[model samples]
Target: MKKLVFIFLTLISTNLLAQRPQTEQGKGSLAFWENLTKLCGKSFEGEMINASENDQFYGKKLVMHVRTCEDGKITIPFHVGDDHSRTWVLTMEEGDVIKLKHDHRHEDGTEDRVTQYGGTSSNTGMSKVQFFPADQETTSLIPYAATNIWWITLDDTTFSYNLRRINNDSSINVKFDLTKEVDTPPTPWGWED
Candidate 1:
């Protein structure tokens, strides 16, 4: 009877452990997810701090609205001037992994060819920062962006979204002031008010 009880207890314990997220990275991802969710329903103004004159975002008004937050996903619309086609979607998957996806849409509410291209967090990023490297889907969708790596950092005073291309010197950083909330922009393309 003792032997049977021991075996049963061990099996139950193992199964419970298997069901939990297993890595330190997973815990960090959860922390990051919670921090991001706190910004839901807020909008902030930002600017591309490193954009060159030729960049599309240069000299344009930038706004990011943390519009939606639900059980396992957060959607933030990024408005660049009058164009309302870009959104950033963050999803919390099983094992506590976080996925970042760029959702782009046409003015008529149609998906763009380069839509839904981003990656997942692969390391133990902190509660205020996370990094995502280009996933296979991103490479398959945008051949030239195979080496892209994107990161977002948040703090009491600022929130920054950044991208870097591996093996290349190209990069962009957009910083939004967290000290003040801006007027929320119009609904992004394909999303209702």
Candidate 2:
């Protein structure tokens, strides 16, 4: 019975430790998430850093609101001109991995047919930048985009979103000036203002 009790205590302690935030890695990743959370309640205008004439967002009122932030997740609504349907969701995954998802919704709070496509990454990057590769859900949704890699770089001066479609030689980079806070735009589809 004493052996059984010791085993039970060991299991409980191990699980408790796992649930606690202790190591530097945990601190670093949480710091990265906090860097983004700090932008909450603010809106910034973004422009495609690299654009061709055919780019739709090139001359539009492109905005991103680091609108909603919580302890382990943040929801940023990205607006293009008058389209309020795209929201970027970032969640703290197990330990240090961060999950990225694009939540597309209709005006009536219905999920778009093509939505929630992203992945998680344990990117050993600095607290300012993290990369997420296409996950299984993304591939199942968009087979051709299986190699899509999305990365966000956040700093005191800028917050940029970069995407590369591997094997397709296509990339998109949009950078927002953190120094310029814009007027808040309309609430995103499926979200309360």
Candidate 3:
């Protein structure tokens, strides 16, 4: 009877373990997701650190609102100056991967022509950072962005959103101060009040 009970316990434990992510990358990705989720409903102010003078984001007021957090998805609205046209949607996928999509919309809440372009993390990134290479959909939507690589890094003090174009060697790096929570921005374009 003792042997039977021991075997049953072992089987249950093994099965439970099997259901969890087994790879380092998978575990790290999950940790990253949890870290980001902690900031839901908060807002932060950002500055463009590496943009050229002619860049649209240069000297503009940048804000990011961690507006929504659900079971498997988080939506963040990125407001640039008076433009509420961009939102970042992070969706947790199977195998501990995260998909990052850029949701762009007009003032009237209509989808933009080049919308929903982003990528998925190819491997389990660090708990504080994740890299996303342009996915097929991104390239299809914007051919010039085929070599784009976007990455986000989050730490206790700051959260950074970055983009690098491999072909042109151009990059955009914007850092948001996380230590201070700012006023929540207005609802992003295309989102219901």
Candidate 4:
């Protein structure tokens, strides 16, 4: 009787866990992705809340356009002043992972040497926040940036992009106001499609 009771309890426990709500580990589910997709085809003007001396270049017109929204990816072109050479490509990876890559291109539609460098989410974060550690590719492409960590946050009113160096005193944040939609910016470089 004791053995039979133990087996029954074990089965019940397993079934309960199976019925629990899906979470970050639910690879096919993307509540966070859906939140971002809501901004498709929209543009927002952002102000650099925090910046180091190196980020002075972005002091010009800062705009982020949620340009493309597809099955499992989003392409946002970040325009800094008159330079439209940077695009942030976020793609869903292998179920529950989100990968963010910086695609940089030149005027003649050629890949820049310092392009395609970004990181993948380290955990299944909440729908509002996702943290991406420096991936191997990013480290290899920019050796000094090996200890970098980037994250983006999406809330009802504001969407922010942030970068920080691990154990270092370097960081920058650009926060866009989602409450007001701005005029869409021009197409980014190498994006005639």
Tens digits of lDDT, candidate 3, 1-193: 9999999999999888878653342578888888899999999999999678899998889999999999999999999999999999999988788999999999999999999999999987888899999999999989999999999999899999999999996898989999989999899999985
- What's model 2's TM-score? 0.84
- Candidate 4 per-residue lDDT over residues 40-107, each given as its tens digit: 99999999885645677555888999999998889999998888999999988885789999999997
Of the two candidates 3 and 4, the one with more favorable TM-score, higher being better, is 3
Candidate 1: global Cα-lDDT?
A: 0.90
Which 10 residues in a row give candidate 4 its minimum summed lDDT?
Answer: 20-29
Quote the positional error of residue 50 for candidate 4 in Å: 2.6
Q: Compose the digit string of candidate 2's lDDT tens values, residues 1-193.
A: 9999999999999888888643234465566786888888999999997787787777888899998898788999999999899999999877667999999998898999999999888554557788899999999999997999999988889999989998986788999999989999998999886
For all the candidates, what are their Cα RMSDs to the real structure?
6.4, 8.0, 5.4, 3.7
lDDT of 4 at 23: 52
Query: For model 1, how does the per-residue alpha-carbon lDDT over 1-193 read when each residue is reduced to its tens digit?
Result: 9999999999999888878653333477777777778889999999898689999899999999999999999999999999999999988877677889999999999999899999998865777788999999999999889999999998778889999999799898999998899998998999987
Which segments of model 2 are wrong by more than 4 Å?
A: 1-27
- Candidate 1 vs 2: which has more TM-score: 1
